[model samples]
Target: MSTSDRTWDVIVIGAGGSQAQAMLAASARGGDVSRWLAVDRAWRPETKATTEALGMTTTALDVLTSPQELRELLGSGRLVANLAGPYYRTGTVVLDAAIETGTDYLDICDDADVILPMFERTEAAEKAEVRALIGMGSSPGTTNVLIRAAVDYLGSAEDVDISWTVDVNDMTDAAARHFWHCFNIVDPDGTIHPAPSWEQLERKTVTFPGTVGTQEVIRLAHPEPITAPRFLPVTRCSNFGAITPIESLVVAWSLAFSVDAQRPRPDLAEVTDHAIDVFRTYRETRPATPRIGSGMQIDIHTDGNGLRFSAGADTEMAEATGVPAAAGIVLLLDGQTPNAGVFSPETLVPADFFTALRKVSRGGGGLELHRLVNGEQTERIRIRDLLSQTAATPA
Candidate 1:
């Protein structure tokens, strides 16, 4: 095939956001540059410069409304790393195209509604010989893997608690959409649950040391609760999002109320866009302290042999999200994942996922792995140290 007609080894959708950039950079960190490409509806100069600097070119392909175009685009790529969201709207479109075109896929989707439906496409993906890994980002991705690690450590898990702190100082459309979607969950009563929820608040004192230490986290229906139980044999699973800059809670609730009251509204995208613009301007006038970090923690409760234990991993969000995502892409490209099927990160990522991720994130002695027996901390491990042990051991 001519160079113009050749398929790209990796195609990243939505190349504008920080997370997407991080993901793309991580993908390029230890891989061939000629085979990677980035796609977005349109490119800002900075985004173009950023991708170019990383040794990848950019293209403008607005395929959101064009399924045939999406199919063709995905067909021309070996693996598609979709970073566009709120994924409730764009996920299935790209995923459907990937399966139809026999293209492997990975996404940082954390929507509970999208996850179950994505899982339902398993048969189709398998039949098409396409491999897919869903929710491969921080909270759901890293948390899910950590919970599995804990489960293995405890023989089995009884309960799993996932929590993360998202500092929304950026005030960009991407950040706005993230918070907006968090409140898009429909309750059993058919009402939209207000997020940054004060009613269902949980006061978590610091158990781990980090930037997000000691905060009031609220219940924001996340995919981890819905999907983690399927793999871990847990009776209870819950996920929480603790938002920084407490005032943002008001903004989240207002957006939720407006969205809920206008049920059947087709202009939801416009609304979010407007809110983002408003917040962006507000942020410009009142610049907040630049946040240096964000993190995720997974705490698992397990009972076996009349004893209870807690085990988990704690790492900054960048390593937690970007590294796993990059690792998934590497595994997919390296044929380390399943032959064919739609699967969650926890399901397909091998035990070496952390090791692969640590290498990609360059997280030397950074990620803390811990296990507590009956509330008394017993084991503490650094990820780099753990990986060294893994590497030294015979397979």
Candidate 2:
């Protein structure tokens, strides 16, 4: 598309944590001549001020009632980066707008209920020629891509298993609160759906990787469970929880239980105040330990031909979450994504995108892929072999 056709190189939909990271990364690339627009339910004066401080523009757009307005605002932007959430409640409308406008769409969604409907909309999106990528954030985003990368190394993957954990405290003030609210809404019944870690009917367990051993992790239903099975022929696909500690999980669980624990109601002022309090507490109690801030650990295991292939990474949560989505945007803008349909990160994003992402991840965080044969672990493996293995394996 010509520069005029792509009026805005990137149009970011929300002024939240992940959106900030995305805008920063895109701007840093510098040559693309990109402009960012931050839109939210209410005018976030603080976020508007922050974006202006960074030299960007901000707009106030209510996601619920502004489709034509959003379409008009999007104009000729080549892509839309959605950062709004409790996605199960508020994501599809934006996706619908993007599809109608024929603009490429991407979001950092991790909600299964939200995604299943989006996936079902793929044919409509394709018909409209709109490329929509879902779950482009950390866990559902890079974690999914990483697992696919590792499975490709094993020559043939018979089954695939994945795990990811984050210290919720590592997120920015707004992000932490957004996550808290989402957790509360999803798990309010005192039972986290799709348990954090489960095996059998996808049984759940908590185990630490490498030196830490495994700790008790609650099983929660995650989008990955739903998306992976539909796309990959693996017999079993599951996600496990590994939050900071039992204490942290307990606190989170408690908040999930309390009526208004993390809900973003009462008023914006109250939400903001509560978010600040949570941030301050995490800072005071956790401090800024080198490895603690916001780190993610992802492990993928596949068994085939009497061999096992696995890959895992321990890195800053922000970078892990931001980079993959940024990379996906790059691919989408460059006309690299093959289809104009709704798809999960792993299903649509190519393997090379991860390789390109690693090159740019130099100072932020590091990613490693591993291979294990007959119960032995090695630091590296071939990507082609891994994909070959998964492809060769029976569904």
Candidate 3:
């Protein structure tokens, strides 16, 4: 099974991560596993076993150093599902490799820094006739696509607010660290601009349909605010996230304070791993299954007119991120997404892509889209219903 000799329908980078696991699960469920390949620097026994069970194959070609290898690995028209992250460092390299290879690309990148630069490659991707979709994860991906739908369904959107809350049960070492790093990035605001992870907390209430009611969420630096403004017509766009059980906020604040103030702070991964170890001890002393669960929401508003809409889903963190990514990759490989240039999920994928994501995530508690008229809830539709309409309509 040599990549140089044969092309692949979808090649998933980073075979060992949680996002990869979810992508595999969604791909299997959708029966899109044929001709799939998983690539990593080194093959893990567990990942190999899982890929075997799913009828997928694995190969080793670490792109970290030899990014140009993608040219030989993926040829023109092939699609690469890049699940590797801490994307501020790795996203662009893989993207450049994809462009140089004339391959289509999609990733679950959530870093604003990574996304902004990738957008600059629009001309290069366009010239190469390759399509690249960035930030295709839950918040930035699903949330981004939902905002596009809301704007089209209601009218022009003046504001878009994205919020996320994960259940305590979904906590993982990698996720803990990823969440930690998101809080400490340098965000400027007239010299007093404190990063969201800088202990400067703001309290706001958020709801997840049929599950969570109004719960307090704190500000966090997420990529949606950075990319949403570029694609959607809006004056305000921001993202907030909180872990359920809420006490985790204290842990994050304390850890981030040390990392921010230390002269030689440990690398983000090291600090995040240590934080997870501490959290594990705390977890063992308590019972499993907290009351609330994981979910995310997108609030879209029209300024001064009081017209608004909110949409979201309640699910485990991995499914929340992976299902949407899997759907995006499927769309790209199947030629369902029409664009051939670098773009955000909101800018490139159509409303039908959101419909596809809703279907992909249906078993994971499904999705809900709601409308607010004059600051009050007006219309609510299950994602399944929306898809039914799409199905019934004639093409």
Instruction: Give per-residue CA lDDT, model 1, range 85-193, as digits (tens).
Output: 7787888889999888878899999766677778889999989988888888876776776665555545566767666666655435665666666665544223544
Residue 6 in candidate 2 has what lDDT?
A: 63
Q: How many backbone clashes does every candidate have?
A: 0, 32, 1
Candidate with best lDDT: 3
Model 1 lDDT, full chain set: 0.66
Candidate 3: which stretches are off by over 4 Å? Answer: 1-6, 68-71, 185-199, 261-273, 283-291, 304-314, 348-350, 358-366, 379-395
lDDT of 3 by residue, 121-179 (tens): 98998888888888888777878776766555555667777777877667776676567
> Candidate 1: which pairs clash?
none
Q: Estimate the Cα RMSD of every predicted model relative to the unseen true structure.
A: 4.6, 5.6, 4.2
Q: Candidate 1, after superposition: displacement of residue 379 in Å?
A: 4.8
Regions of model 1 farther than 4 Å from truth:
1-6, 185-197, 200-208, 261-269, 287-292, 303-320, 375-395
Clashing pairs in 3: 183-197
Model 2 vs truth, CA RMSD: 5.6
lDDT of predicted model 2: 0.58
TM-score of 1: 0.84
Provide the overall lDDT of each model, using Cα atoms, as 2-decimal numbers.
Answer: 0.66, 0.58, 0.69
Question: Model 2 off-target regions past 4 Å?
Answer: 1-6, 16-19, 41-55, 171-215, 259-315, 348-351, 358-364, 373-395
